[model samples]
Target: MDNLTHGLLGLAIGALRRPDGQRAPAPGQGPRLDGPGLRWTSPTDRAVLFGCVLAAELPDLDGFLPAADPVLQALQTHRGLTHALVFAPVWALCATGIARLIYRRARSRPVFSYSLASVLFAHLLTDLWTGWGTRILLPISDQRYSLDWAAVIDPFFTLPLLAGALWALARKRSWRRSLLVGLTIAAAYMGFRVGSREILVRRVERAYPAATRVEVFPALLSALSWRYAAILPEGYSLGRVSIFGPVEPVRTQDLPAELPERAADNPTVAEALVWARVPHVSIQEREGGVLEVRVADLRYNMGGEPTLQFVVLVGPQGETLEARLERGGTIGEVYRRWKDDRRGALPAEGGAG
Candidate 1:
């Protein structure tokens, strides 16, 4: 999920229940809603809300932390230790403490800490829906887990969450009920998407009896549509699934499962095989008869230029040389440059010049 969605989810969680555990206001202490916007009924509500929102975004702090290299950053940085379930409570404690100092509200520290921890846990849960797996149980094990149920950015998911948060931000009397209903609706929608993906995967598996692996990825903005790939011994096939329309024919591309004997030892190839959910490998020749072995993760393609890529340079005699893992389009215009470089260097007759 995106940062804005996380913040709104935090807002909804914060408004789920007040610190006092009263769903309704006191007999004569009804909340005021006549102002420009809804105001927190008490200092404690404001503090907890703020703390939850802050804790929701704290896991992304690793993006700002300096890393020795991109490999380290990809494997052990953002969405690494910070997003782990083990770290959520500790972070919630720190965040709640800061909120206490800021609001100085009359609330039990333990209660506030628990509420904030729940909000942080929500962040981890949301990330698990996307293809970019989160290291939820990190330290215990470095494995990343994902359901591949929702796209990183899904308006269908975010809109309801935002609506609930906004309602809570505006009207105080029934705020708790509003957020609970919103959260339930969002969860249901996610479940629907998961079910849809499962159907598509089954269809693909049935169509390709020889498929060794099959994975469905979420579309950019639509829950009704999905893209999937099935890995076969000789190559792989790609297709799009529409929940509302007839199934389209699958597109097959032939790519050997085995790389050149020389590239078998390349570290870059090893890294990408482990990292990519749908790995597509190709061998190309560059200048000076250098063998450029490329592996791309099709999960992030989204029908556009490829993003995540691992490249290795092999000598003329098939000896492994230097290798690199690169990403395109992350920083804008850089992707275009990478694309243009590849096109311009293409050998007209046969192989590299």
Candidate 2:
């Protein structure tokens, strides 16, 4: 989701995890193993509120790393290996050490390390759902793990949490209770999403009895919603259709083809080619280059926005190519479905045989 929701969740986690107190627990007393520390359970103080926000938001700074993303060049510039899982503990420790030294002057308060850790952990968990995934084991290994479930900007996922946090802030009441309510709502929304996908799948199957394969997901970044694409024969040329609130659903055909090289033949393709200006737009035989190419309406996607998008194979000569795209949650799945359909469309049929 967005920062606001994460901030609230971070705050909630902070509040619940800490101990109930207006005064700091003795240094040796330490917080309960599962309890929040100092500012977490204290009567609502403006500084504590601010600290909660900071604790939640600060860790996301690493979302912009150089080697972190493929299609999105910006991540490569920021949010690097420092944000990985293995690094999370080390990062928190370093941060706590720094805060311990720097904020020792605060006579009546404990350090801010607890809150910092809360925000960092929240950031990592939020990233676990997006398409790009997170590298929790950074220094150990640069592998990425993601649920491939939630979109980057799910409203259902974001709003409830934000509302709960706001309510907590405004009432000066139970931040813990409010946090639980909001997170519960967010969890329910996730359930709704899975149910909604099943609904879409059943509906699409009923509509297109011939659909050999079908896949559905909410539009990338669209919370608690979904989009669908199906593969059949030529009658239904690769198309994208949106399912907004269950009203008869609308469809749009004209999905972009995958082959960037094919654009050389169809000037129409050239006219629409985005990122063509980029140096690496040419075809490359990547690891999983065994597929067709197609362009998706990735404008709504976080990083891969362009008018003239490119795809892998399905070029003029039907060449094998690589996917140089950084995918958001939704459209990437569409591309995968489209590629699956083209397995039978090679220059010579039954090539797989």
Candidate 3:
């Protein structure tokens, strides 16, 4: 999920409950974060509201950490250690301490702790719904888990939360009601998507009875449509599934089950093989006899092309010249130059000039 959606969810949560553990005041009779004639009546309320928003957006800070390889960096950063379930309590405590310092109210400690923890866990849960996957059980397990129920950015899912948050910010008396309705709608939408995915999977299985393995991925911008990949005895079957339509494959390709021999020597390719859910390997001969090996994950794609791809350039003698991960764009000149430099450094007997 994006930061805007997370912040809006935090805003709704903060307005629905009071930080001092007291029940929220009746409509038109409480401290409001905004709107005319409203003033800051409770410092604890302000502290808790901001604390929840900060906690909700804090886990993504792991993206700043560094890694030697782009593939490893992607796997270990972004949704890495900070988003782990075991570290939520620690993060919540830190957020609570900060809130206390800012508000100077020791009495709000328990409230801040509870609210912050809730927002942190909510962040992790929302990320898990997207196809990118999240390492919720990090340290204990580096495996990334995902539901594939929603796209990373789903306007349909975020609209309700946005409306509710706007209502709260507008200082409407019935803000709590709006937020509750929004949350309920959002939950229902998720349930519908999950059911749709299950139905689509079953239909595809029936269609391809010979498939050894079948998996469905959430398609971009539509809950009713999905992309699927099936492992058949001969090769792989790739296609799109429409809940209301037929289960016809888009295309079929003969992809190797393992990385190509030329790319196996590259460390980045090895790491990508482990990280990719449905690995698709392709070999192309580039200019000057360079072997361009592309290992892509078909789970995430746009316009029928893999969005997350790892590229490795191999020399004639099978030495790895350049290895890097491409998120969604074409290979840049920097990569070309890097490969040229590596090729230039090779021994005279290794390959042609």
Q: Against the true structure, what is every candidate's RMSD?
A: 5.9, 11.2, 8.8
| Candidate 1 backbone collisions, by pair | none
Off by over 4 Å in 2: 22-55, 63-72, 75-83, 98-121, 135-148, 198-215, 220-224, 231-353
Q: Across residues 1-353, which tens digit of lDDT does each residue of candidate 3 receive?
A: 88887776766666556433235456866554333444444667667767777777777777788876566677666788888888777667766777778878644665466556555645887888888788888899978888888888887888988887777557554555677677767778888998999999899899999999888988766758788888788766777788898885655656554545666766666667766777777777789878787778778654335667877787776676776777765557434433543233321221101
**lDDT, each prediction:** 0.70, 0.48, 0.70
What would the TM-score be for candidate 3 when compared with the true structure? 0.79
State which candidate, 1 or 2, has the greater TM-score: 1
Give the winner by lDDT: 1 or 2. 1
Q: For candidate 3, give the lDDT of residue 291.
A: 79
The numbered model that scores best in TM-score is: 3
lDDT of 2 by residue, 67-172 (tens): 3123333233233464565555554444444444544433224225555555465677776665445665666764555544567667767888888877766754
- Candidate 3: C-alpha RMSD after superposition: 8.8
Clash total of candidate 2: 25
Residue 209, candidate 2: Cα error in Å is: 8.3
Show how many residue pairs clash in every candidate, following the order shown.
Answer: 0, 25, 0
Count residue pairs with overlapping backbones in model 1: 0
Question: TM-scores across all candidates?
Answer: 0.78, 0.53, 0.79
Instruction: Please state the error at residue 290 of candidate 3 in Å.
Output: 6.9
lDDT of 1 by residue, 265-346 (tens): 6554565566677766778778998888777776765332346676767787765576556766466666555454333332
Residue 98 lDDT in candidate 1? 81
